[model samples]
Target: MGSTADNVTKGSCICGALRYEYTGDPAMTALCHCLSCRKIGAGSTTFTLAIPSPNFHFTSPSSSSSSSPGSTHKNFTVTHESGIRLKTHFCGECGTFVAKEGAGENEFPGLMIVNAGTVDGEGVFEKLAPPQAELWVKHRVGWEGERHGLMQCAGFPDGL
Candidate 1:
């Protein structure tokens, strides 16, 4: 019942106004407890999938991002001290943080960090790799119960 364009899996914003496809499997996955992540999720943590940029694409052929009827994509870039930039693309309608791009070379170079919850189907994220690391445990807000044995770090792991 899925479209051909839904190759790997179809993903969109909460409003279904934005849609894209991420082919193949994700390269890296983790739970981030950084302040930035917490703010975007409005919670203590965020589950992210680092997908290869080449495999991620907007479903529409249009040049603009608002190909969907009711949704729009907005960009926000954060520059680090090293001049590396991080661009986050989110749903303009519902403000759902969809993906993060830019010069995050230490972790997933040339990969985009996407919010796992945005993927088409529910519980699909569970099918992916279990989180191998937990970032910013120092910033963690509360107990999240038990989880897989994750390599805990104060911030982004040097070799992540």
Candidate 2:
């Protein structure tokens, strides 16, 4: 699917303390139903858009510095069942997760998994990139059911 703004997509934290934008199309889009994602999202699933690292940029000024993208966000690193370490960036002010990046020898080394829900603009969530698959469906909630017709994987998608 294409982005809401031609080849650009914008997003921010719940409190608008952090803003970000990415150019070009997402590498992939999917719904993650893994237990860790569920707990981190505080929901049944999380819609994510994977964009190339070079294409993603933080537009908001850092809470502590004007030049760096490091300060003001909390980074939490979690080791997945596959032994892949993923670091998630959460807004320091609102505590809303914005994106995640894989660490050291991970499959998606140059891609950032952006939280689709954080995307800005009216109807952006509905109009932005559509999920191409559902991941970790084995951990999906019983009542949520499945998103029929989409590629569903019990664990990680094949071929990365």
Candidate 3:
């Protein structure tokens, strides 16, 4: 993807029940293995891309899903871990966790985390928001000795 400010990327939940688009590049992208991430149902950490809230928005509902004003397939689950509150949004129909927004001592207040797996595997997803770091590596399970090429942080990383 080009480095244009208006470049936009598309994403959808499994079964395409929920769709979203984020403009430009992400603020940060990282793989996380924190306890909180695991507690939320992920076996270990989550692959996330940080995008400015202002640049993210839901796209038109697909023809297969409801487009009526009364539609509500986009739902979420909320959980708190280590005093951090996070809301994981998913498609109620397919249960695909698509995005997460939260508050924590080290969380970025201005950006929201998008589960990179939900997005298209095009250049934008691979290059524009490819994980550049790993967080909470100390919480990684069996493969604790493995390493990701990105920045490594045993706990929270700076500028995250």
Candidate 4:
């Protein structure tokens, strides 16, 4: 398991079309039961690692701007699409969702927030703590209602 002190973790979608570079230390890493995340990830919960927006970068070698043979860092840019003011760059070929920007820009101020499950590594999940709180508890599945020790909230957290 990588420590919180580690810098520059890399990840990509299953098809390799979407790639990302995360530089900042993740702030909150948790499993979310919100309906939106569950539908998109196709899982019971969505694992997320919230990072600063400026710390995330795209790193597909084919997109490098310089035609020269030796430039190391590829030219990359954050993109916006799908009616979302926040920049959401995904794979052009495979349509794999990559990293997102502008989340909590005005509210939290400086954080990109990528899905930790998308991160590439072994035992990444082990390093994270079990979710401290559950949002949108009104929508939680019936079976989950009896789970022990889960903090439940009827809606998004007051400050969230």
Stretches > 4 Å off in candidate 3: 1-6, 39-41, 60-80, 103-107, 122-125
TM-score of each model, paired residue for residue: 0.79, 0.87, 0.75, 0.63
Residues 34-100 of candidate 2 have per-residue lDDT tens digits of 8778777889999988899999987775524422444556678888777788888788777899988
Best by lDDT: 2
Question: What TM-score, to 2 decimals, does candidate 4 have?
Answer: 0.63
**Which wins on lDDT, candidate 1 or candidate 2?**
2
C-alpha local distance difference test of each model: 0.71, 0.80, 0.68, 0.56
Residue range with the least summed lDDT across 10 consecutive positions in model 2? 61-70
Off by over 4 Å in 1: 1-7, 61-71, 79-84, 103-108, 145-148
For model 2, what is the error of residue 76's alpha carbon versus the real structure, in angstroms, after optimal superposition? 1.4
lDDT string, candidate 4, 106-154, tens digits = 5435666566666776786675444556656666677756345755666
- After TM-score superposition, what is the CA distance of residue 119 in candidate 4 from its true location, in Å? 0.6
How accurate locally is residue 127 in candidate 4, as Cα lDDT from 0 to 100? 58
Clashing pairs in 3: 32-45
Q: How many clashes in each candidate?
A: 0, 0, 1, 2
At residue 88, what lDDT does model 3 achieve?
68
Candidate 2 residue pairs that clash = none
lDDT value, residue 18 of candidate 3: 83
